[model samples]
Target chain A: MANGTLVLIPTPLSGQPLAFSHPPEVLSRIHKITDFAVEKLQQAVHFLVKTGHPVPEYKMGFHPLDKHVTGEQLQDILAVLQQGRDVGVLSEAGCPGIADPGARLVWLCHSRNIPVEALVGPSAITLSVMYSGLNGQQFAFNGYLPVDSHRREQTLKTFEGRSANDEQTQIFIEAPFRNRELLGAMLELLQPETRLCVCWNLMADDQWVVTREVQDWASASLPENFENKPAMFLFLATPRQKAVSGKKSARSKSTGRGSRTTGTKKGLHRKRYNPD
Target chain B: MANGTLVLIPTPLSGQPLAFSHPPEVLSRIHKITDFAVEKLQQAVHFLVKTGHPVPEYKMGFHPLDKHVTGEQLQDILAVLQQGRDVGVLSEAGCPGIADPGARLVWLCHSRNIPVEALVGPSAITLSVMYSGLNGQQFAFNGYLPVDSHRREQTLKTFEGRSANDEQTQIFIEAPFRNRELLGAMLELLQPETRLCVCWNLMADDQWVVTREVQDWASASLPENFENKPAMFLFLATPRQKAVSGKKSARSKSTGRGSRTTGTKKGLHRKRYNPD
Candidate 1:
């Protein structure tokens, strides 16, 4: 019987080594496996070398997404599994099978009943949610919106409608070049008071996570060099209610049931907004 | 200028040894940090001792959430902070201000502009998302849903509507006793075809992470022993599209975009359902 492959090891973000602290241990275990698939052979080699634990001897199976990976490369990976050798897969950064290009391979592994174990680690998605201060309970993460204006607008409208009724938080990302344009479109289309958060260069020394009202964002002049920067955007469906002060009144019910309330609050101001 | 009086340190889930992780290093940095606002004073003390670190000679401040933390105890924490002494806030598990009980204090710090720096460590949210096989680009982490049937239903409906139109993923949690009940409710109220991923006892020896269709879930009865177990629930807005087979034909378009047409073959008996 063949040993199951463990795929999807996440690497740390740039300058944020602590995000995924388990990769080293995971890599060590991979060395004991007979075969291994890596997103980028060179990058993986460098990582192993830097960590002082290079793979001694094993079959190298590069994934199709890697520059060195090809149809033949995939076959090599499958052949290793067929030979009953345990296989391990690792991504270049953060989590595998995310925006990263390891999904197809992982899916193939899943279909084959290969045992896949994903270790816990840091992810930009969770970090962004933690700092956004938006509704965390119900959120949808839409990956990079289409570059085309028509498709982009359609995507934005779709998210807008989703957040219209419930206090759902909608998450999306855009290539740095199109961020400003996307923000502008959001300002024009989304409810003026909808809450929006932008987390840029997260976990790095220059990380910036800021939340503001959509209208406030619309009115601000675009930064001069707004192109080519990686960024994540979070939009809250319901306007954050101002936090209540003072003691609970006699009329305050403990049932904790609350309805959706809406109103336009002016430009980004830090205040507690929990209608409940 | 008075130096910042607040330090936010993230503890591990199992309260394991720190070794050389970021949390302990941050804990050692405070020069005048006299009072430590810990969730569990005895556990924190035991952890500090087990890590072979010198027990700080400073006074200990415990939060009310701790077995001994109370309103009066919180006032003690505030008093120490007001006296210009740095106060370190630690949670019983995972990172502070995230699904943990330190957020109210963090809010107090934010309101007062008391500088707050969060050190990194193990986070269940980050771990769960890493394995969810859902869109990671945008997500919301609603801590735990209300236990009441009406309120819980209302909250679920609100969350469901948020991701209906986009590829956003929504995440929520429930106490151990209500896990099966909540899962049952979710299967009924959510789109039957929506994909659901559940991570139970994350990072522990018996950890289980499963992503399955809701309909598939409805057909089977879950074991009752899961009550009181810590579990994280992730619902993707849509099922990811399968990759195109290599034999598919590529069609050229006038708009310079190429389209691939492939015939779908039925092989595996995988369930088909739209998460939306």
Candidate 2:
């Protein structure tokens, strides 16, 4: 028998109705799968139940999947697929196998020639980029930075250097409780002209997405309740296009070390738009 | 007056029904907006009509937006927002401002303190990471490489070096016409054990997402019609985790230059699963 497909299902980022983030087809797709490997069983059960899955939670196969998911545990999931039953993988939130676990299962299916289908849904990282107003053409999601203040400071310097040198935007996330710590370090360590974007409580009624230069943020503050909510932080230290005497152009500063000097001098005026 | 929100709308990847990739809310949201800045005017009209917008194509405000969107043209869009009228931004496909034009506009909105809202939708980059089954926790989308063969080769070398050094999954794309050329270059240039993933015609009936070592792909061929479709190429040159005596753990290889050597030897057996 042909191996069953492994479907990667993305979940809602907030408590909003599923329709807010997913189309009718995703609802129908969820109804058909009876086996799952999820980041958290309770959350998966809750999401499936919310999706109106016909199967009771008691009868469905729920496998545990986290960063530590083992090869043996994965084999058990593969055994179900080898039996020709489709298994859906879900993250606690957002798309599975991106910032979440279950990638190993997806990789395993690939090795064994099992088909993997990823359903479209909300991804905070993607949303952050779109809302950031930063360079989306080239970017990196560095995941999380080092927790030690000293190491994280060093890492931030490296990321900023790359942003300028490669013209790539750097994106990284933090545990909810550390949002403030990260923001503080960024303001203190990054160059004054570097753009910093903070997106908190995405897809929520109280969501806030803001971008400003580090110098501007030094005096401003995060939302009072932002510390506990999931957030994504991104920055771009790349210089803006060289300013002309008569007109402004949309081109980016060219890449490499020498452009850094030109970018720093001209990029400051990037935030200022005067309708001459 | 408060500046009107700059809504970034994501479009479908293929010609499938809007229901296939977006929810009812997106349609409603599109219907309420009359002003738009689109990558392609014809495609935007087609999409708006498909969404069943009440306004006639002739009656809507459709401004052109591409890499060359001028500071003057953006001033026009901002002028509309300044009047407390919302303006929607659309890419030819997928999410706008992400490997697509319009991020600068999004950035402009941020600079002006205009509320920028990015609705949930399909992102090929996000989907590629999810389906690639590579290291999705950390990844970089390098957009496109140089068109010159030699320059592209050198950039690929740099990307591979970064991937191995930083444990990052590198994502990139090519013009559909040049897909074959890029694939051939990749096969010849990348190391044997590096994993490469190709996702073509995503969200379409004929979509294909596959990941395998460079060695494996060197022996295979792309789908016959893949050359003409919008495609994404991703690779992970990082070494696999250190092999245990009797078990395969899910831990990733550590970051830094030293780990590269350890990753090389142990990673060769990564694809082999002895279910003993």
Candidate 3:
């Protein structure tokens, strides 16, 4: 029999309703996998149940691979595939392995020559940048920064510097409780012209996606309702394009492709962001 | 009347079946959006039609926003929302604006203070890294590298340097026709220790995902089937952990959180690939 493949499953971002972030097809895949390796056993079971999966009907079983699982144990899990029975590795929330704990198992699969695949689903980090209107062509996902105020500020400096230096958009997430501190650090460390985009509690009904220059953010404050909610933040310091000059009528920015960007002279008066 | 929000829709990666990448809710959204601004009008119509939408019954209308659509015209599309009607922005393939053209409309919506929401779908770039088992804490998506052989080689060198220097996973895509040329450049330019991962025709039935050190890649050849398919590539050069050492019965690398890597005296035999 052919070796069974290790499927990488994606879950909803925290606070997001499961179905809101995935399609029926993704759920169908969940229904098919008989065995799973997840961070929190109860949470994974909860997800399957919530997504309309009949756990007993599918005869699904959960195997723990949180921080405690040993490499030896993961290897044993690999034996399931070697035995030609498919198994899945689920990230607690969002796409597994990108700032999540399932990466080790994916790597282990590579080492053991097991076929690996990742299912499509919601990715908060990617969606945040896309909505930010920042330079999406080149961007980095810098997971949580240091807890120390001084180090956190330094980290922001590096990201801001990269944003200016290579025009790479910098994306980072913060612990819900530390949200205010990071925003304070960002306002203090980022330059006035630096653009900051924040998405509060993505995929929730109360989701808020907004972007503005640091200078524009001075007088503004986040709504009281958004405080302590998990958020994704993006900083972009890439120089603004002079497409507003009206010199090039049918110009194309790097990713614009077939879109003609003939900026009408009137557009120059408005705040337009042109990322090259 | 309240304004309708602009929905930034995600299409399946080229060659991926629609249902495989989206759920019924997304299709429902498409069913409701009577107005659309797409990279290719014909393609978008065909997409909806193929997905079982009665285009005429939905009373949908297409407004062109191809390479020739001026910035002024995009603003006109935004006006559709201001008029209390929702408009969908569709990409030719994949998510619009990330690696495609729908971004200008999204940015336009933001500049005008119109609400923007991104629908979730497959992202070949993120999926590649998740499966690569590289450090996901930080990564950059460098859209398309230089096309000239020498320039492309130089670009690859910089990416390899960054991968080694900061352990940042580097992702770049190649035009289908130039796939072979890019692969050849990657092999010839990268150091033996550099890790290269390629996922061909992602989300398609024939997709293939694998990673190997450059040296190991030398002994292997891509399957004949992958030649002209669109592909996502990743290169990671972080220092290899010696956890493969036999001293411990089971040990995990970094994500193990509470565990300390003491650089055990027992761990130097592994074929470590440090990109630097």
Candidate 4:
């Protein structure tokens, strides 16, 4: 028998409800799905109930499909699909299968010739790139850069090299706790005029996105609460942005030093650029 | 005075109704906004009406924003922000500021230090990568490949090289009309064992997404209706998938060379791999 369809369901990036980000049509599909392959069972159940999807009172309604999902478990899940029950794959955040363990199921589906559907939803990667105001035409998302100091520097240099050659914006993310360290390295390693965009807490009420040159951000102090928070970083080596930087320096010279203020009293902020 | 935000609006990717893709909350935002920067005025008006958004009967509601949007016009649009009216940007399809003219305004917003908001929505690039079953952890969206034959070949080789180096998936798009040509080049130029994924017409009833190795696809033919239709392609050079191919070759020796059948005359069809 042909396998049942595998649906890749995208969950909320933050605490917002499903309808706040997903279409009515997408929600309808979720309502009809019973079998779910999820990273976190508790969060998945919470999401399903909050989104108004029918879930049985039994704890077995959601199947855990984390990084540890074994091939035998995948086959066991496929056996359910062979019986004609559709399954939904849910990631911990954002889109399923991208930078998530759900890709294993997607890969299995391809191998078994099972049908698959990827529902559209909020992807922080794409959203960050869009708001970065960089090269939207060409860009690369290097999910998580190396954590080691030496390897991280080499990777950053590699990204800068690729960006200059192709006029492509390079995007990468950092663990919540390591954002401060990552920001410091970027300021020290990337070229002085490279345009950088840093975004924190997307899709929430306190969402903030800011872009500036590395040189201007050298002396900038990050927000007090941003020490351990999810953030995205993007840098562009394009000619147009470099031109913008040139125009900005001219404007800064006329307005006097330390006149450009960028911080706020709110939780998410970056202080004025006062590179001495 | 602070400027009103530059909102990033997402449009439907295919023939689906606007409500079928955008959440009610996102639509509400569209209903209240009067200022807009859109690629096509007629399509934008049509989309707004279909989703119950309020648009003035007057023709001036939509401001033309294409590749030709000028600096003066961007400044002209920025004037609306100065008057405390938030502006919505709509691409012809998918998210604004991504592979569209809306980025110019976004770039301007970042340059002028105006606030910007990118709402959560559908993005074809991410959707394709999610379905590719490749290395989603690290991927590159190369936008449109070069039109020149030699340049296109070189780009594909470079992508394959990178994918091999870091296990990064390389994604690129082509004009719907050139998909056949592009696929041909991919199978011919890319390594025989490199995994290739092609996704066409995402989010619609007729959506199709398929992933297989380049060798298995060598003798395959594209669907008849695939000509001149929007599509995304992704490939990865990784050890695990190569292992899958090796196991498949052994299975082929036992079952037969032309036994891999993958399609049905269903809503979405993925063709078979006939390696004969």
Candidate 5:
């Protein structure tokens, strides 16, 4: 028997009752769904209550990372589909499958020939890109880098090589605890001038999206409350050169010296050569 | 005086009737909008008629691209904002400021510190990425590569470098007429097995999104009737090189010279390795 449709639901941001981008109408439709897979049943219940939706009395299947998703779990979800029930999947917060665990389910669904429909909604990745003013043409998302220095360095090198060739933007994330360490590594490895866009607490009232050179970031003091906050780091290669070194000189010129002084004697001379 | 809010209106695909994403309720809310800067005035008039909204009889200003957008034009738009009137900027299709000419107006609004809000709607880039199944975390959106071979090669080289280091996906569009030429160049420059996702006439009934290896694409005949058609090309670097290569080799060994004779031997060897 053909399994039911699997609807991937994106949860709301922290402290915000509304799911990231989904409107009230879409949320209402999702609430009425009878069969579903949720990352956490308790959180799902809380969300429904806060949003003022009647939580359906369903023994929702759980997809916990520590508990390996067994064949029985898969069978139960499939049975819901076989019984003509539309199964919905919800993430804790933000869009599913982007640096989230929903990817495994999405891939499995695709492999099993099940149809997957992704409704448009709020994604920190998209919103960050929009506000960053970085080149949106080509980009790579490397997810979260390894915490170990050696492994992280190897990963960063791979990202650097790719950015050097194509001038494409590279997006990666780090655990809040290791944010300063990762940022420090990036500043040392990447060109001093490489445009880095950091999106912290996106879409929320306290959101901060800033694009700055690596050297500037290195010099500035780290945020006090960055310990447990979710953050996204986006790096755009210098327009002229794909190599990291090329970006260093460009960065110094563009932000460091360029913005400090007016068009005085030396400024006139600099303007003639570098009219940035 | 504080400039008025810039209402960024996303026009429909091909300026056709019923192509807009915004409904009547949304349009009605912004009815007091006076100043207008559109790609084409006639298309704007057509949109108003198709939507059946009350048209403002005021002599609205039109800022066409052919004519330089001077300070006067900027002032005229700002004057409406000063008088508490909202200024609307519309594009030909899809989202404004995304591979569209309306970016200049958006930049102007940003520079003047005017509030700019982008509503959720159909964006060719976002829609293409959603369907491609490629990495959506990091991406670059280079509008259109130069038609000149030298410049095109330079751009491709840049894309290659980025893909290598960051494993970022690179997206670029080509003039409808030169798509075949661009594809040819991509085949020659990119690795034989590099993946390319071609999205043509996206969201329309005749839309097509195909992911294929560069070498395979080269061997196939060029697509017909692509002239003047809107298209987006996405290139993603394959991660886990050894695994992919191993699979390719195994497939070749089975399908090529040894298939008939070695089939039984391979089956026995596989059975011995996995007793289950």
Candidate 6:
């Protein structure tokens, strides 16, 4: 018998209606899967119940998928797949395998040649990038900043330099309570012209995403209820003027570069040219 | 009157069923927005028609959103928004403001403090990372590489070196026709231990995502229908052991580092540890 597919399922970002965070088709398609590896069992059960999954919460197999998830536990889930029963991988919030522990399970399935499918859904990282109106063409998600004060300051300066040099957007997240501190430190340490974006309560009724230069942000006041809320922080430094380099400058985009229109008869059209 | 909201809408990846690429809720929510800034007019018309938008495609407003889109065109769109009518931004494929020209419009909105909403949807870049089973926590999307062969070769080596030193998953895209050529160059250029992943025809009937070491890929045969398909290529060089440097190694994670469980009272839990 063929091994069953491993489906990566994304959960809601908040307690908002399912329609706001997921497409109905994804919910319907994954409803039949009786096996799941989830970040937190209670959260997954609540999500399933909210989505009206036909199976009773007690009937489905729920395996812990946190850092402590053991190899033997993964083997057990793999055994279920080998027995021709599909298993779903669900993260606490957002798409599985991106900034979550679910990647370990997906990696395991790939090593064994078991097919893996990642469904379309919301990601805070992706949404924050979009809402920030920053450089999405070239960006990096650095997960979390160093907790230490001195190190975090140095890291911020380094990221700002890299961003200015490469024109790449730098993204990272902070725990809700510590967000204010991070912002405060950013205002104090980052360059005056650096742009900073704070995205809070994504997909919620009162979702907020704002961007401004560090100088502007220094004078602005954050929302009253900004603390204790899920947030994503992003920054971009003003791109520096091209320095005179001896070797062929790799940063030059004088050559045409644009999106490749796939499955179109027009083939390739160089529509955009962004200068350094 | 308050300025209208700017909604970032993602289009389908292929000629596949709408249900396969988008959730019903997103289509429904966006159906009533008659004003749009799209990469191409015909493509947006087809997507709206297929999704069963009630209005006639000809009747709805369509503005070109390519590089050629002028300041006057954007001013017209902004005027409509200032008139309190929501306008949608649609890319050729995937999410708007991401690896596309929609970002320029988005930046315009941000400069004016116009509201922007990013709905949940598909992004080939995000999906490829999830399916690659690579490091999604710390990854960078470098858009496209230099097209010149010599520069392209040097860029590939630079990306590989960065990946090894930073433990980052390096991602880039190529025109469908040139994907095979890119893979050929990667095989000859990347180190033996570096892992490479090719994700082609995402969300299609025969979607293929496979990751193998450079040595392994050197001996494998690609699928026959791999050419002329939308694809994302990713590679990760084996992370070199931490070098003993005079200054403190910046990459050290001796302290805790993990996801910040949002909206929950549990605060922070440092679960996983990935050593250098």
Q: How many clashes show up in model 4?
A: 0
Candidate 2: which docking quality band? acceptable
Write model 6 residue lDDT over B115-198, tens digit each, in one string: 888887888788888898777777888766666777788888888987776667888877776788889999999999888888
Better of 1 and 2 by lDDT: 2
Clashing pairs in 4: none
- Interface RMSD (Å), every candidate: 11.6, 11.1, 10.2, 14.6, 15.7, 5.5
Report iRMS (Å) of candidate 2: 11.1
Q: Output the number of the DockQ-best candidate.
A: 6
Candidate 4 whole-model C-alpha lDDT, 0 to 1:
0.69
lDDT of 5 by residue, A1-276 (tens): 666666655555556435324544456667667566765577666765665656545544444421134556666676666676777666555555443434345445544556554433455555555555444434455455555566567666766665545555677665566566777788877777676767666646666555666766754555677655667787765544433323223322432222111000011111111102
| lDDT tens digits, residue span A61-163, model 6 | 9888765677788888889889988999887888777887666677678778898988877788878888887877778887667667777887788788877
Worst 10 residues of 5 chain B by lDDT: B262-271
Instruction: Put the candidates in DockQ order, highest first.
Output: 6, 2, 3, 4, 1, 5
Pairs with backbone N, CA or C atoms under 3 Å apart (clashes), candidate 6 = none
Candidate 1, residues A188-253, lDDT tens digits: the string is 777777777776666566665556667666444443555545577888755334211210111122
**Model 5: per-residue Cα lDDT at residue B32:** 53
- lDDT per residue as tens, model 5, B1-276: 566776655555543234224433335534556466765577776665565656654555555521234556656666666676677766555554454434334445544556555443445665555545454444556545544566667667766665544445567665555556667788788876566767776545555555566766754544576654666777765443332112222322332222111000112111111101
Residue-pair clashes per candidate, as listed? Answer: 18, 0, 4, 0, 35, 0
TM-score of chain A of each: 0.73, 0.86, 0.82, 0.82, 0.77, 0.89
Write one digit per residue (lDDT tens) for candidate 2, span B1-276.
Answer: 988888899988888888778978878888889999987788888889988999998888978886667789999999999999899998788888787777888888877878888888778888898889887766898766665666677778978887776667898876677778888899899999888898888888988888998999965667997667777889988553432221222222323312111000122122332211
Worst 10 residues of 4 chain B by lDDT: B261-270
Q: Which candidate leads the pack in lDDT?
A: 2
Q: What DockQ does each listed candidate score?
A: 0.18, 0.29, 0.24, 0.20, 0.09, 0.41
Stretch of 10 with least lDDT, candidate 6 chain B: B264-273
TM-score of each: 0.69, 0.87, 0.84, 0.84, 0.62, 0.91
